[model samples]
Target: MPLHPKIAEILAILPAPPDGPLDPVAMRAGEESQVPPLEQRLPLHAVEDTVAGEVPVRIYTPVEAEAYGLLIYLHGGAFFLGSLDTHDHIARNLAKETGLRVVSVGYRRAPEAAFPAGLEDCYAVVHWAADNGEWLGWNGETLAVVGDSSGGTFVAALTAMAQDAGFDRITHQVLFYPSLDLDFDVDRYASLRENAKGYGLETGILKAFNAFYLDSGADPADPLVSPIKRADLTGLPPALIVTAEYDPMRDEGELYGKRLAEAGVDATVSRYEGAGHGFVQHFSWLPEYHRVYEETAAFLDRRAE
Candidate 1:
């Protein structure tokens, strides 16, 4: 499908990244400045800023629905820029949509923290949430995770990492247009080449993001870094891998879903046509964007018997 009209309109005027190595501070400030005022934040039952597992997080309680379980949301800025305030609206809306106590993580980014630092924070927060369920309130029957773009990679990796460490508490995972494979040269997917340029998230930006995140000589092919490289996906949590038709990262996410099913893990892949990367957060007004969250809520809404 061709790019959606609204998305195309937005892309037509999209600004290019600075012509040099991105200034993470300036870029972060630029994005954070766009967040609405705290008083202007979308209405929720309650919202609190606190530290979870030594990582900054914002907890959002929905206005009306009883939360099914706790969900840790990892926002995406290609592993470098994005904070609680940058994604506050998305997290609040997700809480409202799914009735899950949503925690948006503000993990340390790179090329400062580099590779495993952010992932470690996310994994720790997941455990922290489980252990602190009592004080956080609403200990529903499940612990789920939802992350988009680069953050989606963390959500997928958490499942594998947790499985190896024998921490099996997570019940569901939702990956929204995740960059699952960072090993760029080997077995490159056509989407990276076909949808390489025009889309808002171009291949160039992806490479730069990967470079910034992995400046510490981390092997991009490591299973934790690229979930697609995981040889064993069996016994991982049930997954909902959402892809955008025109996204450079689209095929890798779908491939991960296919591999998960092959390994006997339940996984569903749904590609939103005419959409590019970050459609879920950047273009929420589109009916198609809403479907991803609907599917996400349905996937994570299980009540324990």
Candidate 2:
């Protein structure tokens, strides 16, 4: 499908990234500025910014329905950008749409807290959220994890780690255009070239993210870095892997979903036709965001039955 006409119109007026090497600070600031005001983001019954085991988390409860489950949402910024504030609206709206208590984590970022540090922070929040079931008002059985872009990468890594640790607490995983494979090679995935430039993820940005997020001695192929490289996808929770039609990460997200299904784990891959990456965060401006939210809510709602 072609670009959604509405998105295309918005893109027309948007400024392109500076034509040079990446500046993490400016990049983060630019992205964060696009988020709507907190009040305009979501209307939740309650929203609390609290700490979970040393990790900061913003919790959201639905306004209209009794909570059905709990979700730990990791914001995406190529692992270097984004924070709880940048994703507040999405988390709150997701909680409202799915009747799931959403905890938006403020994990450490790269250049300052590279690799395992950020991942560990997010992983810790998951455990803390589960261990404090009474406080969160959700049982461990209905817990799930969600993320977009690099945050989705953390979701994939944390889910795999949780399974390996014999903690079957997480029931589902939701990935939106997730960067599952960190060892990115343009030649390896055709989508890299086809959708590399204009669909939100600028070309060469992945490499820039990798350089900042990974330590010099770290292995890119480490399963923690690239969940798609994991040997066994079995015994993992069911997943709803969403990909944007023209996003560079589309193929890899779908590939991860394929691997999960082949490993006998129930996984569903849904492509957003004519949509770009990060569309979920721009719900007020993008109509297709509602479609993804509806699908997400239905998937979680079915698990309750």
Predicted structure with the largest lDDT when compared to the true one: 1
Off by over 4 Å in 1: 64-68, 303-305
Residue-by-residue lDDT tens digits, candidate 1, 207-298? 77777887855578798888899887889998989999898888889989999999988788988999999898789768868776677788
TM-score of 1: 0.95
The best candidate by TM-score is 1
**Full-model lDDT for every candidate:** 0.84, 0.83
* lDDT value for model 1: 0.84
Model 2 residue 80 CA deviation (Å) reads 0.5
CA lDDT, candidate 2, residue 243: 91
Q: Write the residue-wise lDDT of candidate 2 on 146-247 in tens digits.
A: 998888999999999998999888888999889888777888788888998877665567787668887533467898988899999998888999998888
| C-alpha RMSD between model 2 and the true structure | 2.0
Regions more than 4 Å wrong, model 2: 64-68, 215-218
Per-candidate total of colliding backbone pairs: 0, 0
